[model samples]
Target: AAARNQEKRMVADVKRKEQAVAERILENDEYAQVQEEIERQHRAYEKKFQDSLGRHASEERNRQILITKTTDKVDLIDTTGRGVRPFEPSQVTTIRDHSFGLGHNPRKSGKLLDDVIDMVRDKPE
Candidate 1:
């Protein structure tokens, strides 16, 4: 009877060891999965950053080209004292100085703008 109990105890100990090993393997697999996820997220972020940088560079290049074209047009006008109009559509830039009125209110500015009816009706005789 004592030998049978001893054998039963040994079997239980073996099963416990196998269960512990299985749990360790599962923990390792979970850690690996987490690591892989983190790496994938990092790679995705890097790719996004690179794509944005490329887009930003392209926009800057296009801006530079536009600035160059506008500058060339101005230079062409400066050489001609009277500013002759080109056969192609001319680019006319009119710069008007803007002033903020002493009692200017943005909310009412749109409503207070010159209306045709208001101007004709208030005409003094």
Candidate 2:
């Protein structure tokens, strides 16, 4: 009878130990799942931040290109000295001579001579 009691006690102890081990495994699995979720959120945030940074950099580069183009246009206009000038009788003769001169070397006068000719043709009679 004593031997039978001892066997029952040993079996019960083993079962309790098994139940504790199962509980610990469940807790470890829950912890691992929570850790994985945190890592995933961190990676998502990092990707968003990098995308935003790239967009800002692209915008800055485009802005710089526009600024450079505007500066170049301003410099060209300053060098050419081509803008609205007062209509003078002497200027008419000079323009006519310039138009005649353009026939010799089109490259020298270029678009400026074309604009001058257009202005002369458009003048009120």
The prediction achieving the highest TM-score against the true structure is 1
CA lDDT for candidate 2:
0.62
Give per-residue CA lDDT, model 1, range 5-40, as digits (tens): 999999999999999999999999999999999999
Cα deviation of 96 in candidate 1 (Å)? 11
TM for candidate 2 is 0.45
Worst 10 residues of 2 by lDDT: 70-79
Report the C-alpha lDDT of model 2 over 16-36, residue by residue, as the tens digit. Answer: 999999999999999999999
- Model 1 residue 78 CA deviation in Å: 16
Task: Report lDDT (CA) for all predictions.
Answer: 0.56, 0.62
